[model samples]
Target: MAKVIMVQGTMSNAGKSLIAAGLCRIFKQDGCRTAPFKSQNMALNSFITTEGLEMGRAQVMQAEAAGIAPMVCMNPILLKPTNHTGSQVIVNGEVLGNMSAREYFAYKKQLIPDIKRAFRKLEEYADIIVIEGAGSPAEINLKENDIVNMGLAEMVDAPVLLVGDIDRGGVFAQLLGTLMLLEDSERERVKGLIINKFRGDKSILDPGVKMLYEKGNVPVVGVVPYMELALEDEDSLTERFDQKEEGLIDIAVIHYPRISNFTDFNVFEQMPEVTVRYVTSISELHHPDMIFLPGSKNTMGDLKWMRQNGLEAVIKRMAEDIPVFGICGGYQMSGYEISDPYQVEEGGKIRGMELLPVVTVLQSEKKRCQTKGKIGMLKGCFHELFECEYQGYEIHMGQTSYMLNNSVQNVCENVISENGKNVYGSYVHGLFDHGNIAYRIVKILAEKKGIRIKDGVFEDYQVFKEKQYDKLADTLRRYLDMEEIYGMLREAHLE
Candidate 1:
């Protein structure tokens, strides 16, 4: 048995995932074999493991931080939201059908064996397992069948570290209230408390931290400061909502109801001249030079939302002369129509923007493979020798066919665009991952707006991602008591 230490957040997006990842790095650096585990993760952003299993991207990031290959065993259950009320549940990387919040809670208890089975495999090589909790365990109403938080802590007999986000305010109440809410048996499992995302001086929070330790009787292990580590977020809530300013271009992305893999836009956010914003409402869709319709878990549902909110027209009007790009589901929406004969998501058929003479058919079989291809000269106003290298993975159930423009040659059907500087669509996510491709496209847009981009504004994503992991590892080493924590791991008895 591997010694486990779990990190439970006071609320969602309280930096629990980052902390868990940090600990994973710390353990790995200290010469102890480590792995990350989360019993359940509800997010649209996911990755298909090498074993052809789908799991949350957070654990995958953590596993990478630990210098381990990601597996479905890292995250046994994943929920990819289809809409507000329901999501498609994935058990051990296989879809178990769609279920609502209420239904999933009742059904999840039966999957204890699956979670254990996955963990058992990780325990084989891991000397320590860093666990992450979902949402707040303080949800008294949902704690009964809570296989994610304190319930999971109890299940594995792992010591817990409750983390609170000071940046959100009410840090004292958030931690204390959560501890008070947990049952005696559950509360006892929490060995320490952490204050995360602190912005001010450590001395300012010292009194409060001391008070919490004395009053709550929990060890004040550490106070983690707000560090802008460029890591991939689990979902849109964390990634899209960030108010960071990158470049001069004010690129707006539609925050669909079922947005997935929004991380594709993170590359743009790193540039010093770009500002990426996610807007869900039509009024918020201010006049921007470029607009991106990102990937979605449910294309039809989000398209229906686009139509309902009159965003489809906004996008069309904006694309009259301005640039518009779509990826995956958004690519399907850029076509003439979307049909599902098998009715995988909604019944029958749906319509899409007739910007490009293309159509899509939803099939039961999903396409999940990493693909590399060249951006051959696409039919657009600013077409140049775009024989650039681009690579990304696919994770969609729809098969798309394109009706190319008469003049366009040597083009794949997967990438169809209007014969102007307007509409563009591709099945590829992270199309901007290639620095040259992104720089050229942005340079074109910049020329139109009379903005000149300086040299070296583009980042090589392959290099940047590795840098991000190193930053994550180094940040953990600086903030956490890695030596003392490693002592705990060394002392832990594997029985």
Candidate 2:
């Protein structure tokens, strides 16, 4: 059996995923076979494995940090929120159907067997398993059937490292309050406490750290400094959306309420000459060189939101002059109409932006797969993308077909565009992560706007991500108590 160490946070977005990824990297560097496991993940940001299995992107990021291929077993259960009270549940690698919050809460306990089986599969290949927990283990109302936090820790007999976010303020209350809420056995499982995202001198925090240790009866493992990492964020709470426009090339992204896979645009942030901003309202939607529509979890609902908020009209008017691009759900929304007879969303039929010459039918089944193909022959503004070979993944629930005798042409195998060619739509995410795609697009827009770009393009994003992982491991090693962490794993082996 593999020794297990779990990272649980005081609240959501408390750096649990990054800390687990850092530990995975550290373990791999120490020459131990390492893998990451998250029993259940509830997020819109997801990934499609090479084997065509769907999983949460958080585990995939952790697996990458550990230098291992991503697998659905790493995240056995994924809950993607489709609405306020419901989610589409994925078990192992396939869809199990959508369930309301109450329905899933009652049904989750029955999946314990599947969770244990996933753990056993990881144990067979890994010497150490870095487990990541969702939300807070102290959510008392949710503690009963929780299979992702303390519940999973106890099930696997894994020691926990409870992490608190110092940057969010109330670190003391967050940590101590969580400990106060846990049962005696659950509290005992937490072997250490980590204060993450610290931005000040350690001396000032020393007094509080000491008190926390005395109160919680756990060692203060580390006060990790705030480091700007170019890593893929887990979900919509990511700081990427808060970025202010700075770069010469401005790309405005419509900030949909249920946006998913926004990481598709992370590569643009790597370029010094490009600025990617998320605009929510008409006031914030300044005239940009290009407008981008991102993937959404609930296409019909979000489209209704756009119409109600006046974004639908604003984007259609903007598309008349500027280059407009859409991906996945956004791609579906850019078409003439979207029909959901199966009730994938609340609306049965809705009109699209009419930017593309196609119609979409939302289906019960989802398409999840990794694809590689060259961009088809294109015209007009985005002709730069012509014949560009790119690799990306597709994750959506609808199929789009061109309207009869429409002048719009297929841009790629999975992409379509209007005849005017200023508007483009595709179901492929991560389309900009490949060779010169983002660069060429930005360059063309910059030239049209008469703005000069000094830097040509960025390095391979995969290489850039690997370097970030190394930096993450180095940061953890420098700040965290490695000897103590290693001792925990060693003791687990002896047991």
Candidate 3:
């Protein structure tokens, strides 16, 4: 069996995911074969593995830190919210069905066998496993049926390191309150407490840290400082979306209510000359060199929302003047019409932005794959993109059919416009992952705006991310007591 250690947070965005990722990096650095596991994840942010299996992007990031390929077993169950009440339930990389809160709550306990099986599979492959829990373990109403947090800790006999965000304020309360809410058995499972996202000098927080150790009766394992990293974020709770700063080249991305895989745009932020803003409303959206419609979990509904909020009209009018691009759900929305025949989404046909000569029909089955192909002949704003070989992944439940004219050519399953205009879209995520593609896009945009881009602003995506993981590991090693963490893992395995 693999030695196990789990990181649980006092609240959502309490820095659990990043901390867990840091540990994964540490374990890998120590030459321990490590894997990250989560019994369940609830987020629209997700990734498709090379085998076409789906998993949470958080686990994918952790797997990257471990220097390993991401697998669906890392996140056995994923719930993507479609509305306030219901979500699309994905079990082991395939959709089980849509379930409401009441229905899933009653049914989740049945997934124990699945979780156990996945964990066992990980143990066979790893010397150690870094597990992450979702949200807080202190929800009394939901604790009984919990398969994450303390419940999962007990299940896998994994010791927990509870993390609280000091930057959010009330860190003391957050940690103590969570400990207070847990049952005695659950509390004993917590090996240590960590104060995450702390700013300022260590001496100023010394008294508070001492108080926390005395009151909580758990060792203060670490006080990690707030870090500004360009790594991928876990979910919509990410602060990357609210950024409104402008740069030499401004690119606006429409923020849907249930956006998924917004990491596609993260590569764009690598360049100092470019600014990418997530526009929630028309007022937040201003003139930009390019406009992007990102992937959404609820495409039809978001399109409707765009219509009611008048963003759709603005985008359509703006498409006439500037370059417009879309991905996945956004690609579906940019067509002539979208029809959900099997009610995969809210049923019925809806009018699209009419930007492309394509029509999309949502199917009951989803296609998930890592695909690569040569870029077809394109025209207009990014005609330079043509003949450039690119690689990306596809995760969508719709099939689009477009009438190809002189300009539109098949770049795998993507589309482009005629020479005189700039409207294009693709179902592939990570379209900019090819460093040169990202670099070239910036170059094209800068040229159009009559600006100069700085050199050495981009590198291979894998290289950039690996350096980030190392930076994270170095920070954790400097502040966190790795000896204590290793002891916890040892103790868990011995029993």
Candidate 4:
């Protein structure tokens, strides 16, 4: 059986995911076969494994840190919020349909068997499993049938490291209050406490750490300083959206309400001349050198939102003069029409922006796989993209067909659009991840805008990410009491 260590946070975005990932890297560095587990995860961001299984991106990121291929078993239950009240539930990489908050709460307990099966699968492959918890475990009202935090810890016989975000303020209260709310057995599961995202002197926090240990009855294992990382964020709480007009080349990303896989554009931030900004309204959608439409979870719903908010009209008008690119659901919206006869997404056919000579129809079976191909013949402003080979992944529920016309052309094996125009659309995510593709796009945009850009190539994204994992592990080793952590794991395995 694999030894297990779990990280539980005082609140959502309390650094649980990153901590879990850091531990996975540490365990891998220590020559242990490691894997990450999250019984339940609620996030818009997700990934498709090699076997065409869907899982939370957090586990996928951790799997990368552990030097393992991402697996669906890492995240057994993924809840993607489609609206304010309901989420599309996925179990073991397959969708179980949408359910309201009230409905899912009642139905979740029935999934314990499935969760256990996934854990067992991970146990077969790993020497140690680093489990991550969703949100806070101290919600006493919702603790009855909980299986993500203390309940999961008990099930796996895992020791817990409770983490609190000091940057959010009230760190002492967050830690002590959480422990006080838990039942005696649940509280005892926490072997250590970590104050994360500290931005001040360690000496100034020494007194509070002592008091936290005394009140929570757990050792203060670490005071982790806030480190800027370029890792993919799990949800909308990501601060990357806050950056606007920072670089020489202005690239605007239409911020849809249910945006999925926004990480597709993370590579652009690596370019010295590129400024990636998320624009939500017409006011924020000023003149930009390039415009990008990102993937959306609810294609029809987000299209309706864009129409209602007057963004649809603005995007169509902007496409005539500026370079407009779309991926996944955004690619669907760029076409002439979208049909959902199978009720895949709220049902009924809707008119698209008419920028591309294509039509999309949502299907029950989702396409989830990695793909690689060279760019085909291109025309007009985007002719620079011609013959460029790229690699990416596809995860969508619709199929698009190009309208038969001499003007329209297939840009790639999986990408279709009208030629002799600036507008382009494709279902491939991570199209810009390649340094060559990203550099070409930036160079073209800089030439168009007459902005002088330095001659330098962007770093390979995969190499950049690997270095980040090493940096994260180095930071954790400096602050976290690894001796005590290993001791807890040793004791758990001995039992």
TM-score of each: 0.91, 0.96, 0.97, 0.96
> C-alpha displacement of 443 in model 2, angstroms?
1.5
The worst-scoring run of ten residues by lDDT in candidate 1 lies at 486-495
Off by over 4 Å in 4: 405-412, 490-495
- The per-residue C-alpha lDDT of model 1 at residue 438 equals 71
Pairs that collide, model 4? none
Local accuracy of candidate 2 as per-residue lDDT tens digits, 333-377 = 998889999888875799998888788888888888999888886
Q: What do the candidate models score in CA lDDT, each in turn?
A: 0.80, 0.88, 0.88, 0.87
Model 2 residue runs over 4 Å out of place are 406-412, 455-457, 490-495
lDDT of 4 by residue, 1-495 (tens): 788899999998899989999999999999999999999999888888878888988899999999999999999999999889999999999899899999999999999999999998888999999999988999988898898988888888889999999998999999999999998999889999999999979998898888887777799999999989888765757888898765778899999899988988888886776789999999998888888989998988898899999998998888778889889999999988899999988899999988888888899988888887887766557777887889878899997877776444333456554665788888888787864888888888888878766676677788989999999999999999999999878322311
Q: Where does candidate 3 stray beyond 4 Å?
A: 404-412, 491-495
Per-residue lDDT of candidate 1, residues 283-303 (tens digit): 777777688888988899899
Error of 4 at 7 (Å): 0.6
Weakest 10 consecutive residues of candidate 4 by summed lDDT = 406-415
TM-score of 4: 0.96
Provide backbone clash counts, one per model.
Answer: 6, 0, 0, 0
After TM-score superposition, the amount by which residue 237's alpha carbon in candidate 3 deviates from its true location, in angstroms, is 0.6
